[model samples]
Target: MYYQCVKLRQIIIAVYLSISLDGVADSSGPYLASGIKIGEVDQTSAIVWVRLTHEKRAHFDKLPILTKGLKRNEKDAESMPEGVARGMAGEVRVGYVATNEKRAFAWTDWTQVLAENDFTHQFKLADLKSGASYSCIVQVREVGSDKLSSTTNGSFKTAPKKTQPVPIRFIVTTCQSVRSIDSGAQGHVAYKTMLELDPHFFVHTGDILYYDKAPLCKNIKQARAKWNLIFAYEHNMNFHRQVSSYFMKDDHDTLKNDCWPGQTYGDLTFDQGLKIFREQVPMGKKTYRTIRWGKHVQIWLTEHRDFRTSNRVEDGPEKTILGMEQKAWLMRTMKQSDATHKFLIVPGPIVGPDKRGKNDNHSNKGFSNEGQQLRNFLAKQKNTYVICGDRHWQYCSKDPQTGVLEMGCGPVNDQHMFGGAPKADKTYHRFFGKKGGFLAVTVVDGKAKAEWMSADVKGNTGKPEIRYTELLGSR
Candidate 1:
């Protein structure tokens, strides 16, 4: 009887805190705490992701490190740090206009951000002009109320028309672990240095965050908190606010290390992990896609975790990674493309001297059957190249047998560099770097050339040193 009475009192207090003295639902101002992400951009459309929070910025307090072997009892054992971005229920609307154009703003109806989706909403803006820069503003308000909360501004550049001969510059990076972050609240120095080059867009090839690492996330709530904690940093939020990006998922971000379709990380299922990824970022119906950036470049962004055979499965003809449908689409698209250069941006290496005994990606001996088949096709194509992520170190390699070229974009910071070749393998690697860095590619249509630069990350204020540069294709 005493326990029942206490439970009732707790419930009464919760209701009182949620409601006002006037008995109205408490509708307070919602702020843009996570900033905004613009992705899946093309000539005619782009998706803008937004989230409403209870505070102006994410809490900056640090979470306590977990004790060893205590995986499932984190919530009970230790309190979560205040550094998380607390989501709130609210409505969001977007308005956009082409940059430098004296035109009326195009607006969308207010859409509510729900708790089930981590208080996030993605607005798809269509009919945008090709090769044009767009200025966007997002407005937030309380649910069931007309009063405005605040407005945040962002910008992105649309891909040029298919036939237009335009030059393009973009950055590709991978394997950024929050635990490996060198800077505190400032986030990764790679973000600031990449921004300095003024890329048209950025591609995070995968391993955006480490879910299975220490302070393990074993459930949906904990997983969601992980996203809030990583993106809350000033550098991450500021970079995404300005640059349009393409986000991919690998084993770590999806669920666990080397995860497949049917696997589960604790109570978190594979399907739930997929849903969380889509909810957190701006994406379209299809995860695998090819976006054309004028006549010079066409980039194929492949999905790694969504469709694949189990890593534990025996290696054979039936052992596959890209799956049948995606493989078919990739082959068909490559055949029909007339672009000067074609880039297959994958979450893992295709021609890697990856650390031995690691059997997950195409680089491993386990997947050699399928890997060789894909490598053979790429070698025959005109000026085609594979730009990959997932490796901690950076390298440029050419398959000895197939003659196909590949560039591995290294980790975001120096602390994350590991498992790289101790000495450059003269047989495969034309260039290799054990330090942290990113890949910057420039495609010049008029000159009919592409420049690849592998840069080494210095400190936050220090300039990134260009370690290597290569002229790709017929220059």
Candidate 2:
């Protein structure tokens, strides 16, 4: 009887989905490159992202012609011209509603068409109630037609108000290499577990997509193609549909290994890479910013690639990783924040000693002077911690000198490549092998507890074990 009931429910859900899709389009070619996703949610606002494909043939002929003469190597290039040919132009709008109840949906006015044709549309939905869940629908229509050509649905929850005593829970993860996805792995197991856990939000530390490495993306067209393929994956789409996410880029996703601004490789320049990164990801104008989850948790998201000095430069007090402006912003934010728990999310490990020595320029040891300064500042602050990714293993450690705990969340689906065995870091209290998983953090009052959940190579995650528990602030 129980099995029969479950089967009937599944059938009903399938029919409902079919009906919902039926209104969007008739017999036509694909209209959406990627479905809707929610990015960068806060107490009263959120960003909705959608990518639209051309409904008919592309409008490349409308583009202005290039007047400059091409270099010998560039003359043979066909990809850039092809990319221009694929451009589309049309109108798109998003309608959204916020409610505490599941069935009660009262959609607000349709937003202006923010983007058109082979482009990403990021619609900012503001003036929402704090800590409320919202459901949204995106619809695309031709320039003159009143009928909608495409529609997709997604949902997200706003952060809690500053005065609210809401308990905060979130998941942290990183490193989804495209190689893993292409190897015929069914779907990421860790993502499946995350959906079941259903945290308030998800944090991707960095390496969101690997473009610089094997099966390298050499041009803008190739980079965009990679982005499309990554987003089209079932696991990624399913995860983003239900949970709001914060994203940052690391070396592999940007340009090359240990990449920084001004570095050029093949046909991909840093500017081009940056452009694609910003367009594909749901981020604001500035990459490094802060998100407050009521009075209990404050997260500082940092950008590691844009302003840093080249890794080849000699190490000194002048050598920096976060760069000058971002470093200053981080310090000021940390000092001024009154949240019970302050989290500084970096793209690489900030506390542990990397076994690779100076080659690990992004790690703390390579930028020791700046790292020490930041650590000293954090030491004086109450209830501060550092959460990092880029390392392939999980570790819970405290800086011996500053007593700031740094928790490393392992790769999401990529093969664990480094930091498997416990290195000789005296500050490290717990270490897990090269297994892909994420960190689940729970905060109550001024205290926070973290659980390091482990998953196998195939993405099968096991039970989450308590890794660290402590008072966030000095009482």
Candidate 3:
């Protein structure tokens, strides 16, 4: 039976052997290696990204911008993933909105990367000025010395100008890998349901991208070909969502398995790994950022991988998951937030007391002191929400020290049973079977209430299960 299945899959993918364009079956158009996507929406700007077909030496008039070490005689295989965007090599432009003032640093125009390196780019709205909605788009140029280009655009509604407290809303989802959705996890269904609820925006908990488990393909090119197939699944699932979505990456999608900062490239794998990842994912830099919705909410995006010292096999100063600066940034953000509601988003479940602090079933207790410290700090804030993802399950809780509510989303694309709940507060409750669903958040009169809706296990795609609801903060 297994062999039969394998044979069937091969037959199903025979045509994939042919390089495709934009992940379609058409023979025309340039082949694409992967596709990055837009991340969270802010009142000011949003993020955008893409991937290329080849990665090594693109013949844009035969000029290579990143051919730092490759010999001229090397074949296309010698180039990295980003270098593979065009024919043998290529690059990409990550488009984003940034004003000369407020939070962004550059002007609005075409940004390009040379084929010699990786065709990857990231722009921050560090100076994205506060005002009306800002529209953003990225034009992907084929790095031929001639500059061939294609464009994809998206828009984000910036925060409204308000001096005093105001009501706010946003939805949260997680574990949304193409793998899970393909398996009929219904997470996307949950997301659509949440969107129907019409909140202010969307927040992705974590594991936005999954990498550890390779898709059903062999070789770098085939694997990347499968990864690029997500655009199709998204389109078929009608995954075209317009709400603002905040995103953070997990091990599979971001750096790599248990990846930490200062970790040197392991082998040629990482060389191609990083290049492909950069070209394919527009997660933005792994850093800390803050956004305020009126005077009632201040949300913080935490960076967990980039600058961390190391991981916890036992424990060491190198045991930083968020690094000293990010920790400090988190602390400061919490201390300074005057919003009635303050949200802290982590790449991993920040509230669970997992002993290993690894997956969802693990208790949040056995975790690091880092999260505990944040919990202790937020203990003072009556209105706080600590949300997390990567567990591949759904959970909800409230801090005993701080009546603040925290919710866990995902394995959205996967499946996992309920483990248990932390006993921090009467508000700390646990619910299950939401593995393939999303959270709908609503705010009215300065009060925020959240609902956890579980999607019907694919067989019942027409309907979903509303597991439960919880209120996190009230102004």
Candidate 4:
């Protein structure tokens, strides 16, 4: 009797182990790479992006089996299980409609099959009405199946017509260190606060993710994996899902610190990094483009990496930062735009003096001539603002020469590297804080107001204590 009982116990343990292993496999199975994200909303169109995983499996019982009496390749007989069709990709459907209420959505009929294994898909919905709120939905159906495997919903408000005066608000942020996740920190309070504010959209100046620091990613695969890991965080996913994002890449996220084109870092080429960036971040075909938020704001998203001369090059009249073509495009765009607020977005501060000296790449000091050229051009414009990130600290300053307001948005979750030592110079340096937070800008009737909030090391954000209000002339 004792021997029989021990044998039965061993069988039960084996069965339990088998069930546990199966559960683990199921938990780690393929899933949506990231939740749906709304990117780049304009007066008439918006872009939606998502990634889905493809899997292949065969089940004979699930498919129709051939009869034993049937011969191979018989004309009148049904195909065998071996010849049964199975889906190898997923079908993505995106729908949107005008909505006055958030929950009461009316979906349109827009669907497409994801035939390629690219792992990323982008859909552009055009012909949308201006100054209207839209409710959008994204659904993924596995190939050969009629049921949707995953679904997510989001909403965006299109820019008003050119002559319309609409109140506009947006959050500007940068620099989320991957180390924050590794340290097992609590909820991202800064992100939570931004979500609570619920601005029209959010502009990510740059340094969206770090690859050169701890837990670094060396290759394309590793970089993609890092994106997945970061987005998997509950707060991060929730923020992207609910808010429209305009993303730009900086030194660390593109390749390494102070990186430019033509610099290769161990299996990570500029093109490869750019490809991954475009795939992951939903932006226009060109890295640099202009976004018009009605007649209130005209934002120029510049590309600092591509077409830039190496930072090591000597600063002179010929040393170009914006490159010839981009500079011309920017000038043309700025000169033609009649918006109340013209925001020039860069990855780093263009007017401040860096701690390292006057020639560091972080600030525009290194490219003095090009920087001066930009300043001269801005001097002619009206209410032109330069918004930047990468300083890991917040500052509200103005270019002494051109009087253009320069606002440096602090880091989102990383440590403030600058110790707030270099005092304010001749330039307009109003406030500087070494805290992790973001900038909230509100534009109404051609006037703009900016508030800088502080986020503690623990990620808890305080109210907007530092404020900069300016009267940007009439539209």
Candidate 5:
């Protein structure tokens, strides 16, 4: 029954569009409102995500937010009628040129964007040079016509091969809510701060958006509207346009709070949320995978919501959050990798002392069995660390049982910071703060470094103040 439901939803999404095919040709504007996303970047290849919109930017006008009892095309009954960037049918092609070289642009074949895939396309750019910066040019045209409607520009850097022992810096963050945006008029200031750092790459651990929060997204239309509204913000669009990023989804962004498989939030089913996430982002077939930045850094990104037993289930050897296959793969890859530093990127904390009421993540007692198993495995590894999201506060801790290190990046803005957990958990906490910021990690020759800094809501008028810093000697 579940599989059948999934198949039906997939078909519906494939044909869903805001405008007709004829409208695209006659329409004056088919813009790149959501900007572009570069993901799954490796030494010689990367995936570039593009979406064509009906307007130059998102509709941000005020409207009566119909949180419940949603109706399509109902001006007063729709929650975000003015916030959605209506998708249009068009043809998109991307071209690239290395930043350091004065060479002709390498262009890819034109691909059609339709409602079936939200008028978005991910173009795979292969045969790229590692450790090189590249400028991207995206051109869009009406279907069956050579006349270009729009051309957008962006840039990214590819990772160096394992043999290239180059120093690299990257940022990791999580738990961003549209409602809690530091600058409602602009976007989250964290993007600006992180952008200024000029890191080689970035990773959003999860909770990219809140589907259950106000202006509640109860249906597919509203959910997609929420996504459009977020990326429409000036800061988000500009940063993503320039930086290569890896996006992951957790409870709130995936379905709801503490969400698991086979769950539904109002009219939005679990499967619908999953489909929308993949469509909105540039993702591969699987969520859990690893990427090596250079000889010094190798990062593992995990999937938390896909294959997990219910939180209500009793704790034992069978209770799992990463499932069997992903867990085995993670262990195998970590053991085989010869990188000087290995970082495990997860949606939730593994060496945490979370609030007593929570029960979903490894930090809680509900999944202690697997949590302990992972901690034990990580104990023997050298220069390996766990980087997690979901917790609203920034923290750095070491497991008392295994001496494994873990760092939480905290929420996107200062307003979203929570004080639910104890300020001091001496047993595990090395540093803890009820503030909003991001974690910057640098992997290089003689040392592995980490810094946690805070950004203000007032457009980051002040510079990011580093609160804590850790420097580990050579491996």
Candidate 6:
């Protein structure tokens, strides 16, 4: 949606001019990866990221140094050369590690760390002057000549330094299929509409990349088709050459749906599967980490399937989800937060189905078992809320015991609908039945007014298929 006010018009114009020149994916130039992405701008830092076009970075590294001696375009020197080539690499090379050294935020101090376990690359920049609007880009190296070819470039504004609620946005997505996007009805149009929202942040609840090794979605070919859904978008000629994007990987994003340590989809061993993920997405290495927006909101994002021992917990105390290290990290972070609101990016279920009975869901790591532990532990702490996705509809209800609100959002584009969802006009908030949708949340004056917005009708554009919003007052 590229929403910007008159005041931001200059920034937009400037960013586009730089990008148009550097991002030329279709015509043999350096290029940026595409599809759903995320960027974080803070008062002192800004993080920009994107997936790569291949498994390695060969000649890309050489392109940059070769062009170093050449006089850069003076008007937009930082963006000139690089912006002109994004997503234009006709062939794959060494592990995609190319990054632009000039442009808006060229000197803003960026890090390009590969998520060795997956196809994601995370660029975390720190010490950015607070409140300053800056630009950024990626460049490829022309081996041995010191010549550099520029690709991706765009502008972003950092959050304020004040200890108050600040604007933070990024796009979030998961569960994309390759075949559907290319040949299906909506196709790339989905992203076209989402970008209009211009959210402050994006949080994809896993499935960022899927190969469908589990046959969970039905068939092997279908699984391959699913991978095409999201990966194909990021690889699209138009998107890579033009649009900017960020990506994160999940089970499906890595292999098959609801996949984990218990199974392997195809030829990918856990390590090999991680490499595939590392090759395609742009994500920080830390699977579980904290993103703080001012001193008001704290987001604890984690990957549940990555470091678990099968899905079953055997009370051996040795079994873990985040692993001992990540678990301790989460616990420590939770106890240390002083934000007005704490958001846990729980990718799976929280109030899961019971497991003790005959119809019990087995395993220690099962949603009902692990999820319950997490929920109860948080309840013991000061104050926090739970919001998750995976199910295709939206459900909002409060924990009868602690009076905390639990919200569910999902299936932005789905093949099914909810059946007999508990209907609650007001308090018992529930929206849609077998549909595709997303979530919209706004935190104002310490109170967050959020909703499950979906597109009940296929023809709907830019707006949700359906929407239901509720307030979760600040703790």
The parts of candidate 6 lying over 4 Å away from their true place are 6-15, 18-43, 50-124, 140-150, 157-162, 167-174, 179-188, 213-248, 312-319, 352-369, 381-383, 416-433, 455-466
Please tell me which model should have the higher lDDT, number 3 or number 5.
5
Model 5 regions more than 4 Å off: 1-27, 63-83, 456-462, 473-475
Ranking by lDDT: 5, 1, 2, 4, 3, 6
Cα shift from native, residue 20, model 4 (Å): 31
Give per-residue CA lDDT, model 1, range 133-229, as digits (tens): 7777777888867766766666778999989997788899988755665567766767767766667789999888877875567788878877876
> With candidate 6 superimposed using the best TM-score fit, by how many Å does residue 252's alpha carbon deviate from the native?
1.6
Give all TM-scores, in the order shown.
0.88, 0.82, 0.66, 0.79, 0.89, 0.68
Report the candidate with higher lDDT, 1 versus 5: 5
Clashing pairs in 4: none
- Which residue pairs show backbone clashes in model 2? 88-117, 383-472
lDDT at position 367, candidate 6: 34
Task: Score each candidate by Cα lDDT.
Answer: 0.78, 0.67, 0.49, 0.66, 0.81, 0.46
The local distance difference test score of model 5 is 0.81
In model 2, the runs with Cα more than 4 Å from the true position are: 1-19, 54-90, 101-118, 182-186, 357-364, 414-427, 456-475
Q: If ranked by TM-score, best first, what sequence of candidates would result?
A: 5, 1, 2, 4, 6, 3
Candidate 3 regions with alpha-carbon error over 4 angstroms:
1-36, 40-43, 51-113, 116-153, 162-167, 183-199, 216-227, 236-241, 255-257, 261-279, 283-286, 309-319, 355-366, 399-404, 413-434, 455-464
lDDT of 3: 0.49
lDDT score, candidate 4, position 399: 67
The sequence of per-residue lDDT tens digits that candidate 5 reaches over residues 51-122 is: 999888776554423212112232232344534688888889988877668787899999999887878899
lDDT of 4 by residue, 252-367 (tens): 78888888888776677877777878887777779889988878888998888877788888788777767889989999999999988888888877777556553534355678
Assess the local accuracy of residue 15 in candidate 2 as a C-alpha lDDT between 0 and 100. 45
lDDT comparison, 1 vs 3, better candidate: 1
Better of 2 and 4 by lDDT: 2
Best by TM-score: 5
User: Against the correct fold, how does model 4 do in TM-score?
Assistant: 0.79
Candidate 2 lDDT over residue span 1-475, tens digit each: 3235324433543543465567665624335545567888998788887766654323223212111212213212223233322324445676666633546444444433333223667778788788876666667665555666776666677899877878788889987754444223233556766765657788998887766644466877767766755565456666776678998888878887778789877888888878788888788879999999988899999988888887777778888878888888898888888888889888887776555543544444567777778778878888888888887777777777677778888787435343344455655555544556788888876568877775432224344444434434442
Q: Considering TM-score, which of the candidate structures 3 and 5 is the better prediction for this target? A: 5
Report lDDT (Cα) of residue 221, candidate 4.
66
